[model samples]
Target: MTTPGHLYLVPAPLDFGCAVQSPLTDALPDATLRAAAGITHWICENAKSARAYLKRIDAIHPLATTIQAQNIVELPREVHKKGDHHGGFDARPLLAAALQGHDVGLLSEAGMPAVADPGSSVVRAAHDLGLAVKPLVGPVSLLLALAASGLNGQNFAFVGYLPQDATERTDRIRALESIALRTGQTQLFIETPYRNAALLQALVASLQPNARLSVSWGLTLPDGRTRSADVKTWKRTPAGPDNQTPAVFAIGR
Candidate 1:
């Protein structure tokens, strides 16, 4: 029996502009960087971005002697739009390198792959094929936000992105708020960077006056900020400049 190569789930820095926002060494652990540097074969959400990330890491800790472009396979754009499990798409083929005895790395644009990000299908495929899967230590924005939010971390659900439509978004906010209020379960979600202010407004307007809301922005970056308060208190506070930075939003009792 041939031993299969391990599948390493590599996490990327929260911000691609590592040179500007924060040092790459600070965003990811040394072990993760070393693991990433050793894997030449990779399945990533975007080939270009993944290469750029690898290049950055290589600069920090030299990658395999000769990392080539052809070694990285990009996840379909459809996967990014829909998700890895959409229509039960089989991702086994992407792990061909691993099956062939070459250790493979799975990378997402930011944070850990397959956690509130694309690449779950590849992880599932690894399991189905009896390949070993390992996750390296890294920064996860959701958990960072939750920890800083001072909310119920023991019981929480990451609901992913909320609705974009105005009415639907408002309704979704109310429903999530209801759950948080009733069960003390923290409800977590994210919005497009540009839509941060708009969602904050909608959240404040839709949730009960006493319901608590937590907004974390620029996590892991120098200007990172997390603020939590009741709807009424949030409404009284003057809004800051519109944040175009990536952010996490959560609500809990």
Candidate 2:
């Protein structure tokens, strides 16, 4: 019987779609780059983005196969929109290459796969197929924001994207605030890059005066910044994440 190949959870830099992209070496560890460079088969969110990431890696460590020579399979568009964690998506078929004893890399556009991004189904499928799953050391924006935020990092929850409706969004914000304040647990969430400023405003307006809010943006880039303060202080000082950049928001005592 042929031994199944391992699935490497490769993390791309957080600067995806940003105006300025940080060098991969600066954001990813040398070992991760080496591992990524050696993988010739991949299951990725987008084939184009995966090629771009591999090109960046090739500049540092030569790839085992040329970008054009690599076998890349992209997840379905519906999976990207609705997410794959609920078990609706069948990712086992995507692992045929791994089952054939060819190592496969699982990649997302940014940060770690299957964390804030859409690749959990692939990881779950790998486990079910009895293939080794290896996650390389890399930056995760949620944890980076949580660690930078002086909130209750020990007890925190990443609630994903909040509601889009104004009223529902406000209601959800208050509910999370209550949990953060009452249980001393940090509430973390992300917003569409364009809506970041508006969300920050809503968070500042909806949260209680004593509740703390933290916003971290451009995490691994040179212009990266993190600001944390109470709601009342935020209202007075008026600071927030850049509207065009990816950000992580947290609320707690």
Task: Pick the lDDT winner.
Answer: 2
Report every candidate's CA lDDT.
0.87, 0.93
Q: Each model's TM-score, in the order given? A: 0.95, 0.98
C-alpha RMSD in Å of predicted model 2 compared with the true structure: 0.8
Instruction: Estimate the overall C-alpha local distance difference test score of candidate 1.
Output: 0.87
**Alpha carbon lDDT of residue 25, candidate 1?**
89
Candidate 2 lDDT by residue in tens digits, 11-106: 889999899998888899999999999999999989998999899999999999899999999999999899988897889999999999999999
Candidate 1 structure quality by residue, lDDT tens digits, 27-48? 8888889989989899998888
lDDT for 249 (candidate 2): 93
After TM-score superposition, the amount by which residue 211's alpha carbon in candidate 1 deviates from its true location, in angstroms, is 0.7
